[model samples]
Target: MVGVSVLEDNLKDESLILGLLDRHPIGVAAVFKRKIVFASKGLARLFGWRREEMIGRSTRIFFSDRASWEAFGERLYRLLEERDDVVLEWPLQKKDGSPIICEIITRRLRPLGDDWIVLSTIRDITAEKRSLRRLKARSSSLRLELSGALEALRREKDFLRRIIDLVPAGIGVWGPKGPVLKNELLRGLLGENIPREIPHLVGRLIRGAGRVFRFEEEIQGRHLLFTLSPIDDQNILLVVEDLTSCVKMREGLETLAQAKASHLLSQERLALMGRLLAGLTHEINTPLTFMKTNIQIFGAYVEGLRRLLEGAELAGEKRKTIDKIISEIRDITKSLEMGAERIAEIITSVKNLGRKESFNEEIDLGQALHEALILTHNKIKHHLRVFINGEPYNRQKGVPLLGVYTTGRRSLLVQMMVILINNAAEAAQRRRVKGATLEINVEDIYPRVVLTFRDNCGGVPEEELSRIFESFYSTKEEGTGLGLYILKEIVNSLEGTLEVECPKEPEGLLFRIVLSGGGGGVERIFNKTFYKGVQDGHQGIGTG
Candidate 1:
């Protein structure tokens, strides 16, 4: 009877221990040979299975796949052989197959025959791990943002430093406590001899009611202008300029003004000569007209004489002599007629020089180029080949479909073109280049027109190009030196810009003229292939 009572008490103690373990927060299980021998209520709740159902079930039921189950078994057994306890985090599955992260701790319970019993405690850590991962990602993002902001600030600082360094005058920035920034010029200007009272003066200026202060000082025989400007309540900007060189510069400018006045006088004389030449051309045109008419009448008289002789009977030698005399007279009349025509063309070209009237006319640049080509034909006929927008120039075609127009005087533009063409011809002749080429391009870039004249006459040296437009500057011995200067003035009067460059290929000078007040008449122009050589074969020029 006493033995039976002891057995009942021991059973009660065992039931009490099991009941306490069932109410624990962690899931607990005991396994033998990879099969669960005992399971607490918490273990069944963790896996969504009843405690009775979990007991005697294989531990594989808690794993989502065979690989994980086998891996865990291998690691667990390997660790158990070395130590009594092992802790790891692994993936587990619920009764519904939902995945979860679990922190598992296992301990060797005891040995039973050939296999060992193990006790395991599992706690779900999915939510905690997710929170940690999110925190790490947010931290990384913040670090990048902070890095970007710092880099931006560094660049801004460098930009400000570069700007201040570029200033010719000494610059300094002062804060409430002391100087916050000083440029290199400022450091050199102040150097060891900086006045002790300057900082005090700045402080006083900062506290004053005025927004700005200016004064002049002489230190170490250097004349300096000082300006203090308040940036805000706590900061002030200081600028120092040395005025010793400025006084000398003013004197130099006065001398330059005198020289410029002399230059202006020369230009005024040139203008007077131009007007005189215009009047001379007008006076000569009257006599030139009469001379051309008389030449034509003389040609008619010679033809009548030849017909009279043809009707008369004469000896063979006498007839031959009379025929030779008639033919010579006819040839002389033709030469006289040609001379009069050439004189007329020269008069017309002179009259067109720098004409200022009709300044508001809508001028077609292509037409102006054609007229200029006619005026310069004699000058370029022998050696030069000219292309208009990459096509050979044809006198008969007359630059058709160019479609580029601008608001300017047609005569003035023609004169400008004439000057440039004559200049290129002279350059080619001077260089004695065989088969020289000049390319003229007119482009309409919307509200602006670009006229380019490029010549392969061996461009001038780079240093000489800048002085080409200066008064009394010429690259040739016989050049009057006023052609390019006058061309530049004409362009300026039309409110346009001119640029000169030396082309790398073809080795020539390129003159680019950009003019405003331009409009396009067609979507495209100059779309044809023009062969070299004139139709009459007199000049190697064409137009398209």
Candidate 2:
């Protein structure tokens, strides 16, 4: 019993390596003077044995021979002698004859008195190690791709900067939240010291994600225009443009256009008045001409009556012809009153034509078309055939998707109609052919009023059609080439555009005028595609 007690004392404490061995999957055995009495469930499984078959047996079965056992023993001895730890990773045999890759850690403890034994822990790390290798490779690939994209973006930024620098206007760009006020023009335009103090504030004001504000800042007596645009959550761009020169140029153009437009409007008004007067005179000619001829006859009769009355008074019988003279004077006064009423009616027509009203009011298109036709009687009377695509107002199939709403500024419409009809008349006159026809069409296209004027005097010349609406772009020998230009200006002021197309096969000019049908279409007029009037050549009449 005393020797056995001493041998047990020399063995590692059961609470230490015994616990690790209890938990370990690989077999662990302790050799005390080569007398093995230790085996766990894992050790039995490792060696293809039951616990009863392995206990009290040496670990020689786990190795091929004494040499292999001796080598493992040397490793364990070194760990025990140095009072340190040892780790080994290698393949271990499973019960089914498969190799399992594992790691083992051995540590020596001084729990036993005068003892030399090691505690070992084993873990299977083959799958875990392989997974780690794959993750590292994927991370390497992603890092490389990110680097390439970043390099390309850097090159693009440089290229963009070079392009921006060449522009005559001031330009500034901010990228995301990276930096603000990154403009080279700031120093050149605003001086170097201006951006030093609050160089970053501009970026913060319009960062990648936020409500944006526009501000105008004057630097060194020049105007700066601020605009913010969001690229995405990751990037926002603030563009600073110098609009001083641009504003000046626009103002100068606007003044000229306004002047020209006003002049043309005046000319149109005078022309309308002249037409009204001419029509009034023609219409009143029956009454006025008769009244004039009557007055001449009455004057001669009055003179003859006066001479006869003088002869009667001389003959003491003047009282006999007084009633005749009185009756003739009454006839003259009644004829003048009838002619004056006709003139009043003519004046009423002119006044109604010049009436100013909202150009945005919802109106019955048929009414407008009728009124326009009546107003253009002088111009369209002998030349053009007006065709309305849809039926009369009350007979409309329904409230059209695009309703004819009259936002009637009738004067403007009258002017455009005048110009169009006059042009058609002139075309017909030039053709000198009785069958040369002009057709004017109007339709409601849901948020747009489409008015197309086509002429059988044949289409305008291909190149000339584009210029026909340009200010001073006239083929006429008339006073100013401002008629069609002003007509387009008036149409555009009503938020409309006039498009001219001479279809290659169609043999005539088609002038299409698209106006906002009093809805969201007002913006469409500015799209350049929607309006074909008033292009690059602006004779400085910058009505736009």
- Best-fitting candidate, scored by TM-score: 1
lDDT per residue, candidate 1, 44-100, as tens digits?
Answer: 888899977776678999999999999999999999999987878899999999999
Ten-residue stretch with the least lDDT total in model 1: 524-533
- TM-scores of the models, in the given order? 0.46, 0.33
| Lowest lDDT block of 10, candidate 2 | 392-401
**lDDT tens readout by residue for model 2, 49-73:** 7866655556555555578667876
Candidate 1 contains a number of clashing pairs equal to: 4
For model 2, the superposed segments whose C-alpha errors exceed 4 Å read: 1-349, 390-403, 504-506, 518-544
Judged by lDDT against the true structure, how good is candidate 2?
Answer: 0.55
Cα displacement (angstroms), candidate 1, residue 97, comes to 77
- In order, the Cα lDDT scores of the candidates are 0.73, 0.55
RMSD of 2: 27.1
